[model samples]
Target chain A: MFARNRSGNSQVLSTMKAKQKRYEALIHAFHADIYRYAYWLVKDQSVAEDIVQETFLRAWRSLDALNDEQAAKSWLITILRRENARRFERKQLETVDIEDVQVHDDTQQADADVSDRELHRMLGGLSDEYREPLVLQLLFGFSGEEIATQLGLNKNTVMTRLFRARNQLRETLERQGENRGRANG
Target chain B: MDELEFRRRIYADPEATDKEVVAAAKADESKRKFWNEQLQFDKQLRKAAKVDVPDDLANRLIWQQSANEFARYQKRSRWYIALAASVAFTVGIGFTMWYHQPISIGGQALAHMQYAQIEESHSLLPVNLDMVNAKLASFGARFDEMIGDVEVVNFCHLSTVRSLHLIVDTPQGKMSVFIVPERNDIRVPSEFNDQQFHGESIKMQHANIMVVGSKEADLGEMKNIITQRIQFSA
Candidate 1:
């Protein structure tokens, strides 16, 4: 009986170690992308760091729930997004301009690459319906079906929003151009 | 697909490289043109979404995870066994939150000041004032005075005001300047110091310019010069 108990205890210890190993691997592999996604979600490094920390803590609890490595990025993203939403709920976050929150501060944009300025504004201006899918697609590289699953919406709705997001973005750019032209004229 | 359907599909996902979109694009001239234009737009969206990620994020996360695990293990095992561990974890987090509280204003610029060394960004892109002014103008904030050729300048948003963060190369070292729009909520201390930097918040008519420089930098002279130079172009 003692031998059996010893073996069982070691098994438990090994299982715990295995879980730790897996969690560490996940953290190392996906933490940056997770940070990037969180950065975009909250638009601040400190907040993004807080959310990423919480997301991983939660992920450590549910590591066994994730079986497919292929699904890991989306899984982490879903967790981060949910955590971000919960944070918003808890904080009752005010409407801080998200344009500043984009952690993806590419130097190229700072170059004032004029051709893309209007597009940048309209893209940032998109409502969550369009913006979420677009961000998922653009930043995280999630496909339509993956986004649908992550967001708990139908594939059709995700696609429509994705399409409409670009449409609205382009149409908004055109409207701005017209205004600019009128100002110039 | 017909023209309308093609437009809809391309409009929603301009960069869709799926087999169906590819085949459809190849089938017709107008569809091909639409696809190319959409791809070009995709390139721009890709660019605008560029961002900076904190370095050492993974290790920091692992350390955080280890701390929590240690805390949990203590709760499950001997209470005294993890006493030091749990207390350390709690204090560490509390201290960190005190360090990284998502403040109302100047929070992001503060982040740059603190972590630029860790992140190792040695140079800022060459941005003309007109371009910086245009971005600042988007939010109805402008600096009429010439603040000199700062390395980086962009209009950033705080919870309350549209702020501009500038990283200027100074004789002492680099300094981060946040021109934050004024609100009742923003109450940064007039003077503050950290281990590596000492700075002050200079209140302006329509905004507050909080500047942080290396410990050796003369923040007073910097503040006085900036105050004289900056006028909110009403």
Candidate 2:
């Protein structure tokens, strides 16, 4: 009778362990956002996918090091950026074509469809220096401080880049609008 | 505020307080409109980059984890089997050595000397003669010119117990015998076992022996010769 009770207790313990493992595997919940952040940073779907895949692989090995569930997205982004930088350090990647920088999406983003094209185009037109901070702050919704930490820049520098990026985009849009008016007038 | 300073504060943080943004906007009407447009653009950009992950990525990761576990299991199993096989092989060898043969003491030394003598003589008769000498040597007996057409010979020790051996011959059909010097009971009477000299036990002076050989052998004559040569006194 005691042996049966002990076995029953062990089975319960094992079930609990299994449930915890299932909960831990819930990293998939954030994959979409993480991919989006990586895609915004690199501006190439294939490279972004590579970065995401590498990030998740490393995350699987070091999942125990991750403390909070809420921090997982940011932690994954940090890993993606580091992996992308390491790739660059190892070998010079071919320059990505601006036209091909559109992120891959199977689902129709009904809300963002029209504005998303313009956003991608505007980002492509900007210099890499301004474009990176813009992507980090605006697209991924990172705070200026978070962007500053990720890019290894001072918060002041991040703020300056973000300001310049917006001003530059505004100026470019205005010029394009004026040109279109002349053609239509 | 100048157009530049007002634009700086607006774009520095997309989610900055409306009061701070409006303070800058109050200084410059055009700059305020520019901040509104930029904020809209930033929001659009954020919307564009929001990702939707595939449903299968989770299942793939789970499968990979299982594969890693299986690989670990196989590696551990191989080591367990190897450990068990090694232990079994050692145990098997130990059991085989235990029950097989009783070790004879002084047997190896006697065999070594016999091998040396056989190599030197190489003759069937002389080799048998050496065997007789070997047997006699155990009892501290000596002989000068004992002759026989000897055949089979063995001078191996029976453990540490006895070093006595045998030499057989076809002498006078079959008879070149000797006494053990230990038992002399047969010498007191004309007491003989069996017919003729085929199997004879005789006591001559100092010892007794039962011999087996050819029936044509002159046992009486051989006994008389041995009795004359042997000394019973000491």
Candidate 3:
């Protein structure tokens, strides 16, 4: 009986130790992904950094609650989304001027400026409600179910909004084409 | 075949899942063509939004984390000293009260002259044999009753705010010294030259008692016996 108890105790201790190591590795692996997601949602770099840091700090504190390694990404993202919401509860945020945000030219966007510039203008013209879900889905690559979970909406609602959001973009782009052609003619 | 479902699937990802492909397969040609165009647009949008993270950010975060850890370790060292003092005082109340001075304030070339004054003049010192033994052990030295001979003893304000009692054996009469680390703004008399303090200020140590002493009491010839014995690297 004594031998069995000793072995059981050692097994529990080792499992706890291994869990801690895995948690730390996951934190290092996904820190940037969490930061980028927060940045896209908030659109303010500093706030995004704070949100990501707080998310990871909360993850560290609550590591014991996590049971499966595969669930780490979603778990961290859930924390990030919560932190993002809590940001608005404490203080009224200043309305960001999306139009004034200057995009830095990078190697990725080195192609012709005309279409890309129009796309950026169109994206900025969107209301935050429309732009947010689109960014989460298209940019962050979140599934509809994951987006629904993050945004506190049903999966059906997420799909409907995404559907409408794309239609609006297509219509806006088509309208801009018509206006440009009329001007040239 | 609805216009809305077609656009959502295209915007979601170009290579839709089997469920999506089967749904699109059943759709009319016009709707299918719209999805194909929307899929192309979505690809362009994804490529456009994708950002290259600055390389310096990762390096900076690592450096910041390491520096934060180093700072916490330094703070923990001070806390440990305070904790050890509390435990030793609790364990040896009888011995510490009997023999220890309220504070001990003299030594060889370098002295740690704190304000040795007792609130009740009759109250015992906080140190005992074990406390002395601990210090001696840390320095790899055996505890001696006296500080191996001293020079000066005096009481001076540790800062403009607090008083310190000190003793030193300067060639000038074992000089009593009282050095204050707190009064940063006070002008000292011409007798004491103002030098940047490189010594540990006990006020900052989180100990119940504050230590006030000289900045460079240990240097040059003083280096021999006083190197590791004294605390405070800078």
Candidate 4:
């Protein structure tokens, strides 16, 4: 009886170890991209980090439910989106205005080039609806259909948002460039 | 495709490899130039979207998971420990209750009377004097002669004290005699009764004799017979 119990305990231990290894691998492979996605989603670094941590914690809890390794990215995205929604539900009164918070600090802005900071501001300036699909496309390289499935929108809607998101950013960059040229001349 | 349509498709996906978009780009140089510029802009957007992740974020996630799991395991084990302690405490209380409980030989004898009829039906052979003596000898006591018509003779325990039980048919009714060895802890009552039966006990040299019968039966006669015929060896 004792030997059987020991073997059973060891079996449980081995499975837990295997699960931990898988969780670590998942963090290593996608934590950066997932964090970046969350950053753009909330447009706040600390909030994005918190959301990413919450997302991975939830992922660890339900790791066994995720069978297909290929589906892990979208699965993480779904969890993150839900976590972000829950954040809103919990603190509806303390909602941070995206426009008020600068996307990058002054020190980081000092290190970046002029065009980089302008692009960052433009990307951050885009509304959540337009920014999300573009980020999914840029960070994850998700196709129109994939973005639609992830965002729960139709393919045409996702395509339009992507189109308009880039067009707006491009138009702002051009208008800034013309102003810069006039100042230089 | 028209210029506006071409620009819309290119703006939507700079890397659009659809045949129509490619053919449209190939058929028009300005459209092709516009697609290249958009591709360069898309590259810059992709680069900007990849914000700098904190260096310790991955370690923190793994560490947090381990810590959370440890906390959960501790909670579960604490619950198990509490459950085990309560179970052990209950068992200890039960054992103490059983150990200190007053042993009532007369009450046991009365309770055994209900099974007396069942025992009578199960006994294959009528117990004679020798058979009764054979079991009574274990208590260092025996009957000199036949006290009555012995129906069933067996050894039983009355409140953890070993005893000999003999069911006999008398002129009054069926009576059960229990020959329980004398123990300091056991309380052999002088008289006891329940709704169905009443019992009388007698303390001898080394054992207690409890005679029980139905409420209507006279136990005095059966008690007198057993007391007169039984002898205890010193």
**Interface RMSD for candidate 4 relative to the native interface:** 0.7
Better of 2 and 4 by lDDT: 4
Model 2 segments more than 4 A misplaced: A1-26, A89-96, A100-114, B18-22, B25-32, B51-234
Model 3 Cα lDDT, one tens digit per residue, A43-150: 676777778767766765677776675477778878888888898897867747545654432224443333665565566666777776777776557888877887
- lDDT against the true structure, per candidate, is 0.74, 0.60, 0.55, 0.86
- Model 3 C-alpha lDDT per residue in residues B62-111, reported as the tens digit of each score: 44544655787799999999999998888799676654433222221122
**How close is each model in CA RMSD to the real structure?**
37.7, 15.4, 22.5, 10.4
**Order of the predicted models by lDDT, top scorer first:** 4, 1, 2, 3
Give the TM-scores of the predictions, in the order they appear.
0.53, 0.54, 0.51, 0.69
Poorest 10 consecutive residues by lDDT, candidate 1 chain B? B116-125
lDDT of 1 by residue, B57-151 (tens): 88888999889988888787877657878899999999987766545454445555665444322336566676667766644556566566577
Model-by-model DockQ, in order: 0.34, 0.36, 0.13, 0.66
lDDT of 2 at A139: 51
Chain B TM-score (model 1 vs. true structure): 0.47
* Docking verdict class for candidate 1: acceptable
Stretches of candidate 4 off by over 4 Å are A92-114, B85-107, B110-234
Give the C-alpha miss distance for residue A76 in model 2, angstroms: 1.4
Candidate 4 chain A weakest ten by summed lDDT: A104-113
User: Tens digits of per-residue lDDT for model 4 on A6-66?
Assistant: 9999999999999999999999988999999998988778899899989999999999887
Clashing pairs in 4: none
Q: Candidate 2: which docking quality band?
A: acceptable
